[model samples]
Target: MNVYAKNILRFVVIVFLQVLILNRITLHWFPEPAGALFIPAIYPLFILLLPFETPVWVLLLSGFTLGVTIDSFMTTAGMHACATIFMAYLRTNVLNALMPRNLSEYINQQPSIKTMGWMPFLVYSGFLLLIHHLVFFSVESWSAASIGSLLLKIAASFVTSMAFILVYILLFTRQNVARA
Candidate 1:
């Protein structure tokens, strides 16, 4: 199977999950107001899974398209698009910083638990997720608001999104653990 075809399929599946499943999860499920304070974001997993050698222009375009698609469904204006584009832009820098200096064999491969090892993959995902959340909430809160509440929302959502992302990576990203 072609890699791009598989990635497109993943893109569809993730968008569907976000729009149909995760988006409907109410805040009332958690403690009284905590639920209202947090909304897990897992859609960024698609962008995070892109090939390591994908070009900057491609990344930005893909991110924008994905974000716009989600925003259309959620009717959240263009906040998703903005955050997603920013996340995509930062992905390369994060990859360079975390990956080993030797890049001979790693080019064009997806960063997965199996491919990059657990720690590197975790750190990479964490850093990107943080940037995504920060940009997302900052855009969402770009209005008259309370600083404490905004921070609380960002913090709560960031934690939930991270936990959800890690679980998703563990379950979905092909892990090629080797036995000694």
Candidate 2:
């Protein structure tokens, strides 16, 4: 399939899953301190999957749009937009830093375990997820007035988001490898 068509499909599927399925999930064991961190916000995966060769401006625009879509559903104003754009800005540098020296030729491809190896790919995803979750939860709890709780929330949410992303990558890795 064409890249544009595939991207549209991915966007639709992920948005549907996120808003319809994941949004309904509530872990009673570890509820958000401020009730805003339960939503996994997996829509950023779409931004992460964008082709590396895509223009920075295009990536930022797409990230902003995706964030806005999620914000519209979650009613969080521009929090997601702000976090996503921040991550988008950092993506290129992260990719460049983690990529193998001799494998720079694959700059046009969307990053995956097959393209970047499991360790680097996980590190990249984990780093971005941490940043995104930190910014998102911090903004959501801007008036909490407790630095300790905020740090704990960020750390917990980061671990939770990493688990979600790791499971997602594992589940789809086979399909991605088959296609490649």
Evaluate model 2: give its lDDT: 0.79
- On a 0 to 100 scale, what is the lDDT of residue 110 in model 1? 85
Q: Score residue 34 of candidate 1 by CA lDDT.
A: 39
Best by the lDDT measure:
1
Give the Å shift of residue 168 in candidate 2.
1.7
Top of the candidates by TM-score? 1
Task: For model 2, give the RMSD to the true fold.
Answer: 3.0
Against the reference, the lDDT scores of all candidates come to 0.83, 0.79
- Writing each residue's lDDT as its tens digit, candidate 2 over 9-97 gives 99898889889988887543255554334655577788888886777898889889989998899899999998999998888888888
Instruction: Write candidate 1's Cα lDDT for 1-180 as tens digits.
Output: 698999999999989988898888744334655345455789999999998888889999999999999999989989999999999999988888888764445766788877788889888888888888888888887864566666667777877888878877768855446753
**TM-score, prediction 2:** 0.87
Off by over 4 Å in 2: 28-37, 101-104, 175-180
Pairs of residues clashing in candidate 2: none
